[model samples]
Target: MSKISFEGIGEVAATFACEAEVQAGQVVGLTGDGTVGPCESGGRICGVALSSEDGYAAVQIGGLCRVAKTGEEVTPGFAKLSADGTGGMKKDEAGGTEYLVLRVESDGMVIRL
Candidate 1:
């Protein structure tokens, strides 16, 4: 038999219309335009999804979860942000300012909100 390849992805807690393409394990947030995309500063987060899609996608919006890492190692207490204002988590910028991190994980990272 010829070698074959496939992709397996799951759904999330809640389903919402996506303003942009969202990937599994990516940090998602609500945009000012009232659509779910990627988490960014000064924006509200929904949560991480289980799969990647363009239009309508499932969002978790709560609880401990696994998110995509944005080239940054996150510990139990590290703060995170949406990578490039889209999916994926990255370490918050330098500063002890508030609103540093949206979700803090004990082992991994919880989704958006």
Candidate 2:
């Protein structure tokens, strides 16, 4: 699998709302139903609800459905934001990994990578 670094993203001040359109009524510390990653690697961290405000905003490190208990896939989404406001998902075919489609509506800036 292809791995991306979360540290590359700068820093963002926001919280998570624990709600996802993909998942229904299943809320966790960080909803896997939505997208989370560094805002510098080409990803946008929005609330995905009403507006891009409120809730815990996170970075889009990578995308993986099922919960990773083994820790092998325990790569949690980073919470950093880059001032450049450039971040998004990248297709890594060489790594046999497809960054799932995730759109959040938190309170983070959208950085274009």
Candidate 3:
């Protein structure tokens, strides 16, 4: 089989902030101080950043998204935050907080919350 990617599958939510640019494909989490960065366990996994930008970054909140996998293989089940504490998604067994895993793809898993 070949790789697959899908965009614009859900409602897009974004806001303007003073934080630095957010890169695409990176898991973004809203910080306690009202900023965005790589998600961490327990931190809110908002969605994947659309692209790198200084302000007004677009975030994909719901639906299917092609994200970068943190560790080993993943299955269709609960999605776990990255073990490295970088807010990335990993297989539930990777040692991190768990979230509902919608669908497990070869490159990443689709999360909805």
Candidate 1 vs candidate 3: which has greater TM-score?
Answer: 3
lDDT of 3 by residue, 1-113 (tens): 43654444665666534246466767777764546776664344666777657655577766766665666677766656552345356654535566666566666666653
Off by over 4 Å in 1: 1-12, 32-34, 39-44, 52-54, 78-86, 93-113
Q: Is candidate 2 or candidate 3 better by TM-score?
A: 3
Q: Candidate 1 lDDT, tens digit per residue, 1-113?
A: 21521112233377777765666766677763535776664333566666556577777755455555554555544463444355655555552121223344443444323
Off by over 4 Å in 2: 1-50, 54-85, 99-113
TM-score, candidate number 1: 0.53
For each candidate, what is the lDDT?
A: 0.53, 0.27, 0.60
Which candidate tops TM-score?
3
lDDT of prediction 2: 0.27
Each model's Cα RMSD: 8.5, 14.1, 3.6
Better of 2 and 3 by lDDT: 3
Which number leads on lDDT?
Answer: 3
lDDT of 2 by residue, 1-113 (tens): 22543322333333344333322111122324543322332222332221222333433222222211110121223323211222222332233222222222232222222
Score candidate 2 by TM-score against the native: 0.20
